[model samples]
Target: MSLGDDNGYGNDSGRTDDAYSTIGGTRQTRTRLPDGEGGDGYNTPRRPARASRSLITMAGVVVLLIAAIAFANMGGGDGNGNDGDGSGKGGSKPEAASTAATGTKPVTGKNGTIPSGFAHDEQGAQSAASNYAVALGSAGMFSTDTRRSIVQTTHDPAVVESLVAALTKAYSPSFLKNVGLNEDGTTPSGLTFVSRTIPVGTKVTEKTGDTATVEVWCTGLVGMAGPGSTKPVSATWFTISEKLKWVGDDWRIESSSQKEGPTPVNGDNRASTADEIAGAVEGYGGFTYAR
Candidate 1:
């Protein structure tokens, strides 16, 4: 699986200065009153009082506007604003650890490169599903023998026979050819067939003593890599939902299906050349993913 406005201030400042000027002008007018005029003769006009009140109201409004802007900038963390962290739920929950290292030990036992002997707990179930996703999405699936081994090893024993037959039919010679593989699922001469699934994370959707459903977010690279290759390797992100059963003392897939992605926005990184991609695929090994 592949895993995946501005503010104008110039006129406003002038208006603010005008307000201050009005208050200053009112004070200057008051100072100009006759020195010994009658007590009621120099009464300040209601206009100045109204202007003061209006100024207070405008200041209050400005304060409120500033507070609103600051609150918005702070995001309030109320689960409504998009923080763009890819949780897509705003700030409601801490971002799901899509690609963070879990620090959990990977499975030690393997059934021919497909992890086996999972612990039969929620973690184990998730681990099993993720690793199974990698196995099923690997270039091995294009071949007969490796595909059979993967199916038999990762699938529940009760359904292995049916799954093998079905998967075999699904990966027909025509399909292999379309993917730039030979009739026997081998890559053509001087070309490297790349089909690798890197799980970003796993979530247990449902779990019980003997059964569990897990979603593995994954990014996959598939196609042939070589000069002048028609099918250059490309990446795709998808989520694989696996229904697993505690069979034969370990988690095994009962059924699994894939959906297109919780894909992240593309970055501006330069795409690597075909040879570079092929070499990377060949050099770097995959991980045994856990929750």
Candidate 2:
């Protein structure tokens, strides 16, 4: 179900509190209209053998359609997996920059005396942007104090206040209630709330000295991953483009925008039980992302 500001997937500047549930899986089954009346206790007219042939033909058509869908899914949507691969543009420079470069590394220097240094070059900037995106889109952003700290620390000083205000309004009381969370961002009893963005890859779409715009095409794991949980965590893919500026010796996000991904189909992995999933979340702590 989508909730709480498109789950922070966009920058449209409005609180869109909407939620939806997928009954079974991501895809919904088509419901067929039931027969109104059974052919009363009498034998219905025997249809011609040709009618049976038509039914068989119809079934064959459906089978072909299903096969096509499966084949397409097997290829996956080519969503950006740690790079611009999902963009359907092959040999793109940004996608290949990291691997193609022989001897280049991010220039790390103290920015505003903050702990983590910013990447100095375009390549470094792209890497930094990708990792930063992961942290911002993480589940930790849901907790009240943590969320505030994250916004303040991760965002550019020039934009932090505005972003915070917008995020504050977006994650309002009503919004939290709809997502099954309290006004203070606490999870309901016996349920764990989860949200995290996993960066598949980074690409420097456009760059210049000390300032560049990089797009981190990412596949994120979100939702509550646990047992007896009404809202089990799920995944979503999107591209977050960030404009970065070298400030006090570091790259910082000045402004940003998000777009829906070239999402792919679900793989054939076995679905774990709720208890097992919950245990995994508790047992595992996410990483401090870097490109």
Residue pairs in candidate 2 whose N, alpha carbon or C atoms collide under 3 angstroms: 82-200, 82-201, 83-201, 139-195, 224-233
In model 1, which residue pairs have backbone atoms overlapping below 3 Å?
1-218, 1-219, 2-218, 2-219, 2-220, 3-218, 3-219
Instruction: Please identify model 1 stretches exceeding 4 Å from their true place.
Output: 1-103
Compare the candidates by TM-score and give the number of the best one. 1
Name the 10 consecutive residues with the lowest summed lDDT in model 2: 62-71
TM-score of candidate 1 versus the correct structure, residues matched by position: 0.65
**Model 1: per-residue lDDT, tens digit, 117-216?**
8877867887887676666656565567875776677766765564455445534577456546787778889878665566666666666679876656
> How much is 199 displaced in model 2, in angstroms?
0.3
Backbone clash pairs in model 1 (N, Cα, C under 3 Å; residues 3+ apart or in different chains), count = 7
C-alpha lDDT of residue 136 in model 1: 60
The TM-score of predicted model 2 comes to 0.65
TM-score of each: 0.65, 0.65
